[model samples]
Target: MTHLPRRDIIALGLMTFALFIGAGNIIFPPIIAQQAGEQIWLAAAGFLITAVGLPVITIMALSRMQGSIENISRPLGHVTSLLFTVVCYLSVGPLFATPRTATISYEIGFSSYFGTSSSHLFIYSALYFFVVAWVSLYPNKLLDSVGHILAPLKIVLLAILGLSAVIVPRELFAPAIGHYIDHPVSEGFISGYLTMDTLGALVFGIVIVQAIQSRGVSDPKLITKYAVIASLISGVGLTLLYVSLFKLGMLSHDIAPNAVNGAVILHAYVQHVFGNLGGLLLSSLIFLACMVTAIGLTCSCAEYFSQLTKISYKLLVIVLIIFSFLISNLGLTKLITVSVPVLSTIYPPSIVIIILSFFWTFWNKPQHVVIPVTIVAFIFGVIDGFKVAGFSKLLPDFIQHLPLSEQNLAWLIPSFSALIICIIIDRYND
Candidate 1:
């Protein structure tokens, strides 16, 4: 396989970055900085841990693992691979993430314009999803077009937002005293993971790989080399943007004393800098940017699942878009709140698996070691998700009556114990 020219590699990297830096990212960092105050840098560092680091690692893992999502989990057998892929895609796409794109687009984009009418919002969102569904059905040209429009709009709006904060004199607010006192760095780090942009990076890595293949770089070694370079560039760009946004958020506290949420903070910034017209333009841009992301995610999920199940891609895209549209009515805040526990539960196992794959050559019996350990970790992770989401009450009385009932870290003990046992067992087997 001929190596891609350096310019082509950079272009691919930029495309990869464009794919990962979607709507949630534009809103998340500033919120973190606003809440973190003096601890903004600490929070930024933490966010990078998961947001940037994990994503780069994921790309490396994918290149190392080769093939599709199924290939990465082959050590765990076909059923487990299929199940894991389904859960990951659903979590990242329609089940939780896709609807969020629409809801957020509405909240940040149209909410100020449309006001608080549930019926109207539903009708508008239904129409938006119809467009998304249509675009997904004709993905190739549609994605390129929407992406072209949205990517630049995102950068321009954000540049204006960032510049406003940079020019304004910062009057730092007193940091809120809280239980987040002892280990701000660690708290910030974990908080960063919540962005889940890194997870998106991992899922989108396959898309990047395919893009490279389409360019005729089919050699595994060449693919891996270019993928790493591309992911590095993308990760750096995302981390810088996150940091800038967080700082902007911190500064905006002084500018918009009434700004409650990240969306409000952003709106206030635009209004302050550019007045009503600017604010309206910003909102419109956000709507288009978010719509583009939603379309990409929905199409990606539908296409992948359709391939896996041998279903018609058009039918699958329509079904998923309809489902996503129905759920999008839940509203932006609700979607973010609902997704957290699920992400917390699933993300750890996925991260661990990706990390482990880097050392595939080190494990003489990867199936014995990796498969059982991942399953055990996942079982605990699932329980932890339920506990966090307040679903433990639905468990059998006997199960809920177990020793760790009152403890939020109920999954920790069993997950670690299983991991340790698996490592020891694998050592002996080797």
Candidate 2:
């Protein structure tokens, strides 16, 4: 019969927002904006759909399913659900997103001061993960540590930078480049995959729920209600932040014309506008953004693995931290190179599971529809992954002719076709 007061819910929402706006969310928009140029708004719209919309929807789904990815994915059967859940945890955990948080904070925040030598990166990541470990080891304190304190600080820094981007005058936007010139919307949509928020949402589901439970709210209805409200707050925050970053990227061409990534564009813009003090502001912002996310990931990963293997949560945190540190040493550019294809392969299936879970009550035989659609999505998703990794020859020629193939969304049509067919079968059998 417990009910969380209004402020507790707001902090819970901010904690969720802080968890989602990690390295990828902060870094990707600027690069997308810079490249999409005059087509930036079109691209931004696409990015928002996946980055903001999908994650919000995901949290809503998780809310109903009692904040467990396993619950939502249970229709896939035990082994398949276990495999899928483990892969998702690893993908957004130590293997990719978590480590990227460290590498990015270093490169964007401190790399200028310390220089980008491999030794420097190693030193910084070591210190970074140490702090992540400290915070993550005590998940019970997350609402206070992250939600009330860290999230607010991160938001203030972001607000300062976002306002600067909007209010400052700069040169005209650069011309649209590459696929962005013609397929800006789809390109932006695909690029949103790079943010990995949807995957993060799956992993963070329990974390959000636990944060609410920590406040003594035990009613399932209240839990779901609070979780949905948190997601809405986070969604609105992400939308505003992304819009400003897109504008920031468009204005940065004159200052960082040859930038390779959003980090470079962000660094240059801050320096051009704020000078030495800007370095301080940028570093503070990056640290807060990356650190909160790293803590959330580390906490979530440790908690899951501990249950799966019955190991000590603290030990898992240490092991995962070390592993993530080693992988992060591969550095930012290389990590992105390695991750894009993997993400491409996995994202379609994950998206299918999340979106379809909403209609679980509608179908008597959810497995029939879920399994077939998932398989089709994963098959074409792997083909798209191969294409992204420059291994297109490994794929048959017909894949190239798939609708939306050029956008790396070649899986869409066939997946839906499979879903429709399965739905018909499910209904007829019923």
Candidate 3:
């Protein structure tokens, strides 16, 4: 295996961290922690498991596969690969995640400051996307430039927020009713999955791999080694930040009621520590961080499609920006609620595939192992999405009255069954 130079390795690690730490990272954990209260650390641990550990696994899988997103799914055959790639790409980019960047940016950066008029919100968001489109029109070293600048700023703002919670002395309140109900750890574990940062890491892993290849590191084994190390560094940074945010959130419970939103908790914490000026200053930093992330996602999606379709990247960027700007007017609460079902359906299959691919060599023919299993898993996952979104009522009454409807665990049941069947089939075939 060829060794990457130490400096290059460090740079790659920083870049990986930049890719993972976006607006969601800053917003979600605190909300979970505040809600979870006494269970904050448990939830943070669960989140780190998926948010950090799974992402590292994704990079390692990509490195081992030594291919594009399409190639990674090639073990499922050409048609399956095509379908999976299209779904995965669309999930990450234009269809789901890309629009989320704009919506999140508006919620965190502008909503607090802007008036309640939908027209004004749309106008400001349009301007926001216009700037994103302009910056992305010509791909430059701007990703690197902006990443370098904002990465530090993000860290500084986070540190300030964390320190404020530590030094200012706030009391913690009782956990919310559903917060620690049933199994707190399991709830936290599952809620951690909702951060969606792991999925981001998986998508961004391709970018890191390409960056490595661009630097002329062609050996698959060497790429895997560097990617793992880089992902670990990034993961550690993410874990630390999450823990701090969780703590800060839990500490904020005494200051406000349980119904306070995450942004409100954050704003209060900042004001408590730094006063009004400090709150505004932190808000400004968050706005820039969110904008930079939005720009990066827009540029990445536009460039990828441009390469594939020979469409003008500039035009695509403009279209995506305009659409996302319109979408951003939906407001944060609605966006989060609307996105959950879709994510529930899409993310599970991708994660399962990433996990299964690691054991690909164990199968007699990898395609035989991957294709049927993924298809079955996805079918179940889609059913789960429908149930979660309250669409199960659309089914015939008798069908809806089945045992499955009572449990409300559509994917869990079929997915486990599929896994068992796959294992049996693989073992007998081998």
Candidate 4:
């Protein structure tokens, strides 16, 4: 009988936290706080729901199935499962989130210390992805590399910064701004979409399963228990950090009232509180955070592509690194702008899948209810996708009038309503 020690559980939890806290996770909360002002708690509620709750639920759900995403979609049949898997991989991989990690480390970390020029970005990304490609070639080592070494370093730096923001006062916070005045929680929820951790969690579940197995924890129940522990650790850590960052933003809005984005807000806050050393701390934190996420995404992408194409993992790693490096040089803002439409299209359906995966057996009709609901969600998802791309402005007035449409959750009702309809039809037949 193999016994997994308490240290192993803690290490897994640490790595889980590290993997989840990427560039977007680090950047968004403060800006939301800044906008929400005195309404910080209300806004934080919404942010944590998607940012913390969604990812935790996702990991726990996947863990129960032994962390195989395909198991969740098996009821959808093979072809659809493959397509869903590909979209998930691409969204978290080179097409959007992966590239943004490098760019963010440069923008928020390096650009703060150095200057933000294209040549500097070019050199930085090449060096960054080279390291990612190197570490990712061996997936078995991530628990040690990320869990023991990198994760702690990231945790410590963020802890120091987060605490300082709490202890010091930059200025009195202003009133809730704009939409935060009327819809703090909903706006915060919508803002959490920018983090995209839920989407990443679906892919990272595989990484967690592989790492746990590498440690000889093979029983599905034990693995799921440990994964649940890891997820709780991640959820608690993320929620605390977000609360701290939101406080900082609330207090420092005067310093960056018209700043371009959250990066600028973070830079100003860190520098004001800690001085030159603060900037160095921030740089190190971003580097470590981005590096871990890059490694995780790189491995996940390489592994999935290798399985899909029958190519070697080594070859896929090299290809993904090269592609991500090229795409990352597009810079953070450009990459985000390009990603909005794609994220809009995929994220709603991804959420639906996570929810359905959990409730699949709840009604005993996974095949009948889940697939139809997902298709309807995706259809409405495409509509929201176009709205994100700015092409859906001409959409009929009725579309804008749907419940929760203002917060970009227009698909929630229709998708769930479809499931209910399916359930009713099945019940009558039974």
On residues 273-314, what C-alpha lDDT tens digit does candidate 3 reach at each position? 677686576666666566656655666666666767899978
Task: Supply the global lDDT for candidate 2.
Answer: 0.90
96 in model 3: Cα distance from truth in Å?
Answer: 3.1
Tens-place lDDT digits, model 1, residues 105-207: 7777877778868886798889888887877686554424443455556656666666666777665754733423554565666666667765675567666
Q: Between 1 and 2, whose lDDT is larger?
A: 2
Cα deviation of 278, candidate 3, in Å: 3.1
In angstroms, the error of model 1 at 381 is 2.1
Sum up the clashes in candidate 1. Answer: 2
Between prediction 2 and prediction 3, the one with superior TM-score is 2
Clashing pairs in 2: none
Name the lDDT value of residue 349 in candidate 2: 97
| Alpha-carbon lDDT, every model | 0.72, 0.90, 0.68, 0.85
lDDT of 4 by residue, 1-430 (tens): 3557888788899999999988678778878877787888999999899999999999998899877677777778888988888888988898988899899898888875569989999999999998988889989988888888888999998899788878875656568888899999889988987578888998899888778888888888888888999999988999889888887787666767855668888888777777877788878888988999989888888887887799999999999999999999888879988898888888887888788887766665677877898898998888888788888768898997889887888998999899889889767766
Q: Give the 10-residue window scoring lowest on summed lDDT in candidate 1.
A: 403-412
Candidate with the larger TM-score of 3 and 4: 4
Ten residues in sequence with the least summed lDDT for candidate 3 = 402-411
Worst 10 residues of 2 by lDDT: 167-176
| Residue 375, model 2, lDDT | 96
Off by over 4 Å in 3: 1-8, 134-143, 166-176, 214-216, 312-315, 329-334, 392-413
| Clashes (N, CA, C under 3 Å) per candidate | 2, 0, 0, 0
